[model samples]
Target: MSSVLFHSLRVKAIQPDTAEAVVVSFEVPQELREVFGFTQGQYLTLRKEIEGQDLRRSYSICAGVDDGELRVGVRKVKGGVFSNWINEHLQPGDTVNVMAPQGRFFVPIEAESKRHHVGIAGGSGITPILSIMKTVLAREPASRFTLIYGNRSLRSTMFKEEIEDLKDRYMTRLVLHHVFSDEHTDAPINMGLMDRGKIEAFLGTVVPAAGIDHAYICGPFQMNDEAEAALLAAGVPEEGVHVERFGIAQPAAGAGQVGAVVHEAKPGDAEQARITIIRDGLKREIQFYKDQPSILDCASAAGLEVPFSCTSGVCGTCRAKVMEGDVRMERNFALDRHEVAAGFVLTCQAHPMTERVVLSFDER
Candidate 1:
């Protein structure tokens, strides 16, 4: 039987910056490396016990994967149980259960390619973008990076000093522009929100769209959408724009929370659907509830182990393939249409529409 060990990991340090924001770093145990190896823009799902219930939250990795340490920046939202708990109670050496890194929000740089990469981010959305920026800057010799970061004020921006140091080190290759929405400053370019006009103006004046090969955007849903639109309007191709949404927007009209109904059944019964889970060389078949909208939920409820970060379809962590039968997805902000047509299904958003389904997570 497969198992997920709830290892007690020590929190090496926690640095609280703004009132509701913190930068947390942890030292991973040796055995956890197999689970924690991640690409640039992946995130970790931290499972913590709060108020006698298991609360899970996804936090994007801010540090480069090669750093050999795990770190994430979390911005606490009002009344958010997990975020508030991490900011208020989490401390150095504190133990918590965290799932392995799981996401496809990043692209690897080719060794011989020279590209101009840009990132548009705000608030805690800078986390994954930071990882992607740092990784690309380090991996590519002729690559250049430019960041257009937005925040309410200077005090609210996370990793201010680190970003500045990066700018100084990269010198001509790395550029950063800060936009403060609340405070008016002496700098003429610093006074407005990153609306469509401002984003276009910034791109026109700073990094020309023609020179940029890739654009990564992460922020509020509207911000991401606007940034992509602005980029596309400025002659950037639609394929060059990659978006990572922080959270799901409000469900559209008539859309409800997706769930399932569990029922007891025999192992080989035809009515009992089969879910194939493959991770790290192990493969197993598990039963599921037919009426549910997500196999991820059913697997979690049945005590089957799977690698997942966000339960929502926003993060691609729970992505797997349907090799045999058909499945329908609820909402997908992570995968594009081509990926969906290629049999990729976000398990967190997948429900078997057919009687038999075979899926795989082991495909590279």
Candidate 2:
């Protein structure tokens, strides 16, 4: 995991992107430049206190690496405390606790490589995709990018002007397609949600799936699933497609079930289990009950500070390597199969299935 320590950074500017969204820029001090340096498509975990309650949220970086800016887009969701507060009350000069950027949602850009990349995003999901698109266009001169962005309407589209500017600047190398669900467009293809059929049509008409070097999908679960399926059906290799989900999906029945049948602990089952947590080269041993919410919750209850955000298991901030025990995850929307096979588990969703468990955050 990348550095998870929070740094006090002052908000340099706040520009409204939509009626319910704003783009915030932070002032990173020169001393912490190296610590805050982030790759494209990474995100920052912010911590704030409201009415004596602590809240943490992860926001994706929207600025390109070569742009020399550190900014994030915040869209107010219905009943979203952190997002609503940010859109309504956050102002320039206000300080925020921001963790260093962390994520694995990007492919390496090579200047001499002539690759065709596609980005499929929905609403605010464009944040990280914007970063990747801009970086690829700037860093790799021979690369071409096609963006298929979906939103409810133009009014709710964040970074609308910035995207238009990018299209104008990279007219020949960039292809832009805006799909609006609630707005009318002259082109038939620009209307309606991006579902499986629409994605398949796109692969067949607009961009050839065989010519695409990399495909990125970021949005709700259904959209991501549909787009990935279309890509795979079009003969794109599974390894060439990447996805990022904004929230965790409810686990299906019998999901994550291994060979053994694991059930909730009963009165006769072992109540307590020993847990070893390693972070920053330090080890902490703690005992937790089987009924404890999760390993993350238990670690926090023991007064051990472990980095985490979006405890719903959407963000991979709390991922750790399980060294010596078997564990079951309640839900997992962030980790890929390769990582899971390598013994990595999201501590926020993990529960001990063994008597003793040893986990490491420093193992990457």
Candidate 3:
């Protein structure tokens, strides 16, 4: 896979967005401004050393393309090492390693287009959606946006003030809805979790499905699935709906008995394999074992660095194409069916099923 180098940047400020989340802004030097220039809805991968252990995490860029800022939101996750450290100790003037913006969670925006865009986000998933919303509103004056944001409570919502400001600025062009799981409001439609029923009701009443030009959904796995289903059932085209998943949910007990079954290799299924990896027009060969953690681990063990985040396969950062030879993916929740048919695989979850395998990140 292609290696993405991290640049050490100084933290300019940390603004608290909520009790458990903060918006982190980094100082991008003039020399690196072009390198760090990002599109809306892209994310940055940050690496840091905590107590002698190196940890890397990806956070979505919360600033719009024209916002002239390099910022991301970090929500403190319970028992999360990096998140907790950032919330408690990270401050101005601190130097941290951050990769340039990377992600495909957005669509093209045109100033002359008058389209209706809808964004459905949950909790911290609002980071990327906020970027998209701001960019769309700023770049496309003729376009309108409706946001359906859900959180545990109003106190826990990130970017509350910023979103409210956006609504105020784009009074006639923007529509905002807040759904809280733990809070009660005068209107029942604004209360409770944004499940399938809530989404369906919202589509049926406020935003008609047929009139929506594009829809973006980002949240937990179950919420993503439910929202997508409701949108498609409400007449939204499959290509018009975009979904970005942050993580995978643990399967319920006995749920794997049906659906697609991924086969695990036996001890002697394949003793060894010759792996050839192509990156930036360079090729490296390494010997791999079938029982190894993953093709990504084997390549890393051999001193080959590749772009990767959320190694559990939720993020598509480590995607590569299998040029030649067969491979089996242990688990896949990122790549679409077309990408799989095109020989693309998430190296982090892929294992060699043949003796000789050739893969290239350049193809991706």
Candidate 4:
């Protein structure tokens, strides 16, 4: 559970990053500064009520650690309720509910270490990468950073001017490359979608896998995987690569809501499973059908508002511990091997494998 507590923070400012995106800054009161302190690549979850509906969405913090500010880039997408509202209506001084920063997209910064870092980001995915690059450049003065960002066009590129400013500031240490999908570039190789072949070509030339101390990739699902695969094929070790799974909101088919599913049992496997969830010192039991997607779905079916965002198992907001019986996660990208071995599972992806399962969300 990634801290279910929400704090009311006042919006400090709003700057338009692009036509479809805005950079939002929040004012953290003096007393809550410590609570809002965050790492480079973490994110903040914002909750708001719109038209009688409570909506929650997560955005990566775009400010660097040493900058001592809290900000996030919200890019409007088709049918994105919160995003559209933020870009079109949000104003300075408005109060919004925000959760503490949470994510695992950054590597530890060592001031004395001289290393080469690579970052591949696309569209608004550059939010966290911007933080990482700024922190690295500011903290580890000896390290060099390389960024290959992709977008549809210059108009759609978030943080374009800021990234350029950083390049000018650290001309010798920062390398920046932009790839546009809809716009033509002087370099023919940088004018296409950043797929596996494009990323491999960059890996082979501009950003080689050899001597890379750390690599961070965040983009659309396919592009992220493509960049990771290209780096691996180019000999980048598994541990050296850190990927943040972006674009978790799969729009609901007919409704505007996201990730809403009908709970039903599998055709042949019709046994109902008993699931006991322990949250905030309260115990609740529910009957779950095995064919359902996850325990999180079971919680939702029972009208339990479990702490979950990006129910796709990318964020660890719905992580809990399995105390009794057994559960198998359908997929996991949040928890590490050690955490999984220690009984921690992303409840969003966990499916009860036993007839009776007891899980606790209070424990880390």
Q: Candidate 2 on 244-351: residue-level lDDT in tens?
A: 888644356768622122335544333677999999988889997887878898999888889898887788999999998888787788899999999999998888
Estimate, for each residue in 1-364, the C-alpha lDDT of model 1 and write its tens digit. 4665456678989988677699999888787777777899888888888999877778899998667778999999876788888998888988988777777778787768899989999788899999998888888868889999999999989888889888887998898888899978898676787778878888788779999899999997778878889999999988898888877665566676432223233333334477777666677777866554478878777777776766767777778888888777767888887789899988887777666788887764
| Clash list (residue pairs), candidate 2 | none
Cα RMSD (angstroms) for every candidate in the order listed: 4.4, 4.2, 3.2, 3.3
lDDT of 4 at 290: 70
CA displacement after TM-score superposition, residue 165 of candidate 2 (Å): 0.9
Q: Rank the models by lDDT, top first.
A: 3, 2, 4, 1
lDDT for 194 in candidate 1 is 77
Better of 1 and 4 by lDDT: 4
Question: What's each prediction's TM-score?
Answer: 0.87, 0.93, 0.93, 0.89
Ten-residue segment with the worst summed lDDT in candidate 2? 257-266
Look at candidate 1 and give me any clashing residue pairs: 11-93, 260-292
Question: For model 1, what is the error of residue 36's alpha carbon versus the real structure, in angstroms, after optimal superposition?
Answer: 3.0
Clashes of each: 2, 0, 0, 0
What's the distance in Å from true for residue 162, model 4?
Answer: 0.9
lDDT of 1 at 222: 74
